[model samples]
Target: MNAQTKQDLLISIPNLSGYDSETRVLMERACVSERGNGPVAYGACLNRQIASLQGAPGIPNLSGYDSETRLLMERACVSERGNGPVAYGACLSRQIASLQGAPGIPNLSGYDNETRLLMERACISERGNGPVAYGACLNRQIASLQGATGIPNLSGYDNETRLLVERACISERGNGPVAYGACLRRQIDSLSTLPGSQ
Candidate 1:
């Protein structure tokens, strides 16, 4: 693709919050190298790369991926580290942290299910106990939580806090308590049953 077209493609992709200048340059190179291929084809290649990095299941069919979806896949791939699977998880956590503080992502519904899930988890995690504090302490806590063998004590947390933690664990980390869904369901049911709920 031409420089302008490449720039446009980069701009169109969502969840590029974690890519630094060097990473962006790499993505640009990848796009240029695959410029002969159509957008869909290029997107598919990027998605496959991401799947490899995440150790996720088979490569998704990217024929249906729009520019935005393709961008997310690209981000996923570019986030991969040489250290292996744990590094990939850490990269994702950092990406999620950066996106949490960014402006609201428009056309969120336009993203595919997986991308939507990622964005939702990021947003939920951003809603901390009180004001959102994107500090080292929070980052350390999230990292430690991801590495912990058991669930942390959340008894003192309110419904929102619990919900955020549960969603992050289930969706982002791929590890959550079996009762998480049931707990969330019960909370939702209780809220809806309360007076004035629609």
Candidate 2:
């Protein structure tokens, strides 16, 4: 990833500073890995690394949770294995709190079903990254879809090039809003300087 993409990924992690030193280091290392995966994959990698260091936490009883919630929790815990049990558990707890209207997570209830599902998928994609990372990830996705950031102007390009630029920008959506806009601006800059692109 480019610097802008890396920066966007870093900022999308909620309350990043609140994480312990080791966890923070793990996240940063994952961000720059050659795997070149999106934020969600990076988060999952972090979970695995943490689990490896700490050994997996024993499974907790899930009798109290409804089937859906229990399944969600089970999948989460199982995904992390024994890596960083504390971080993994805390992330799941934060998700539960968000569902219950806790202050940290945004109110996503009002969005259309499709948009809501996208946001939920965004969060789940980063499931093991912890509350702060996935919380911020969901917020960024919502904001991007809502057009909180302005799209770059592509009027200077021909139809074919413009279509390509738009598609390129959208492909960076997983990196968050900043990277999307940056991708557009980068394309505009690079393409405009080409001999015939003007």
Candidate 3:
């Protein structure tokens, strides 16, 4: 992150000492990488964390799920450290959708190898949170990739150049999938500027 962005984040969340080191790091990274809206993103993240920690009760009710599914949902949502209600509810919702065999979750089978690899890595990072959470993570990251702007089309590039671009993009992934996608976009844009890269 740039010095100015870092300064802005610290100024916004002046007392991050209460959070563990890992969460603090993730919070800062998520905030800064949130489509360049650091302060607003940080505030949202902070609110979520606080709400979750306090058991603020805005989470989805278990009225419809069966006993086993409700138990699984609770375990999946609470298994992750520092999970907020928004994320927890999202996990529950995804689990419900998965149980119903929902059709909207994009199939990654058709994606190019490099893009698939990055998406896999992003989801793998959430594997510890259980199957429901992992599925949720995959859905979220794939949506992010699909919705993101400026992702260059790689059909014109040869295998070697594509691999190089993939490695370059992954190397610049500072925090998570959003930043990784941004890096991929930037690397491809940089290639366009080269004299004979076409």
- lDDT of candidates 1 onward, in order: 0.45, 0.59, 0.61
Regions more than 4 Å wrong, model 2:
1-74, 79-124, 128-133, 140-148, 153-159, 167-171, 196-198
TM-score, one value per model: 0.20, 0.37, 0.35
Mind sharing the TM-score for model 1? 0.20
In model 1, the worst 10-residue window by lDDT is: 129-138
lDDT of 2 at 120: 68
* lDDT tens digits by residue: candidate 1, 1-198: 799998766644433346454433444454455546766556655544444445433223334545543345335545353323334445545444554555323444554454344434544443332122223323433344353333335576687867665665464332222233345455545656769978
| Most lDDT-accurate candidate | 3
RMSD values for the candidates in order, in angstroms, are 18.7, 18.8, 17.0
* lDDT (Cα, 0-100) at 51 in candidate 3: 53
lDDT of 3: 0.61
Q: Give candidate 3 regions above 4 Å deviation.
A: 1-114, 149-155, 158-163, 172-181, 195-198
